[model samples]
Structure formats: structure tokens, C-alpha cells
Target: MEKLLTIKDVQEHLQLGRNRVYQLIKIDSFPKIKIGNTYRIPKREYLEWIQNNIGKTVFL
Candidate 1:
């Protein structure tokens, strides 16, 4: 089975603030799983997200 990551784990891995992560989720750019009031992201999905965003700048 794939590893599941908590919000905190993702924040640390990406070196981003909680609010930033939440914001990303709001924009649907970040992959997230909502379980009750908590959020989780699959390791594979996270890796895929990174790969998909590679070399893509926010400001064009």
C-alpha cells in the first residue's frame, strides 16, 4: 500500500506554511484527501504533483 502523509508531514517536506498548503488545496493544485476535519495526501500523488509542476513557474 502507498504511504499516507499528514498535512504537517507535507508542510515539512515542502517547507511551506500551513496556510500556504491550505491555499494550494483551495486552488486544486495540490492533491488532498479529506477525512473528517483532517486532510491527507498520498505519497504517490504528492510525488506526481511535484513532477507535474516541475519547471513551471507561477508567474508566466
Candidate 2:
């Protein structure tokens, strides 16, 4: 099983602000899951997305 990351984890990982993290989540291709009112990102998928989207702006 893979780890699921919270918005704060993502903010720390990407060195982004809370609003920026939420903005990224709004992008259609971002790897995320919604559980109730909380959002969780799959660690593996996020890592893969990083590798794949290197040098590209992810927020839309």
C-alpha cells in the first residue's frame, strides 16, 4: 500500500502556500482523492507526477 499525503505535506514538499496547494488541486490532472471534506494525495502518484511534469508549471 502507498502513503496518502495531506495538503500540509504537499505544501512542505513543494514549498508552496496553502492557497497554491488548493489551486494545484483544482487542476484536472493533479493526483488527488477526496475523502469526505478532506483531500489526500497518493505519495507515489505525486512523485510520479513530479517526475513527469518537471520544468512545467502545474497550476492552471
Candidate 3:
């Protein structure tokens, strides 16, 4: 199975606040899975998102 990352992992990796990570989760394009009350992000897609958004605005 592919490795899944929690919101906390994403926050730590990106050095972002918890709320910011949660905000990203709300974006349809952002890769995520909702299990019960928790959210999981795919590590690979998260990395790709970082790559694709480098030097670009994350929100319009």
C-alpha cells in the first residue's frame, strides 16, 4: 500500500500551521482521504503538489 501522511506530517514537512494544512485539504485539487473525522494525504501527491506549486501562488 502507498504511504499515507497525516495532516500533522504535512504541516511539519511544509512548515505550515495546522489550520493552513486543513485549509489545503479543503481544496479539491489537493490530494486527500477522509476517514471518519480525520484526513490523510498521499505522500507522493503532496510532494508533487509542492513541486507543481513552487514559485506559484497556492490560492487565487
* Residue-pair clashes, model 2: 0
Stretches of candidate 2 off by over 4 Å are none
| Local accuracy of candidate 3 as per-residue lDDT tens digits, 12-51 | 8989999988888898889998999999988898889889
Model 1: colliding residue pairs: none
What are the per-residue Cα lDDT tens digits for candidate 1 across 1-60?
A: 889898789889989899877777675677788999988899999899889899986421
Candidates in order, TM-scores: namely 0.84, 0.92, 0.89
Model 1 sits at a Cα RMSD from the real structure of 2.3
Better of 1 and 3 by lDDT: 3
Which pairs of residues clash in candidate 2, taking residues 3 or more apart in a chain or in different chains?
Answer: none
Report how far residue 52 has shifted in candidate 1, in Å: 0.8
Candidate 1 global lDDT: 0.82
> In model 2, how large is the Cα lDDT of residue 35?
97
lDDT of each: 0.82, 0.93, 0.88
Q: Which of candidates 2 and 3 is the stronger one according to TM-score?
A: 2
- Reference-based lDDT, residue 53, model 3: 83
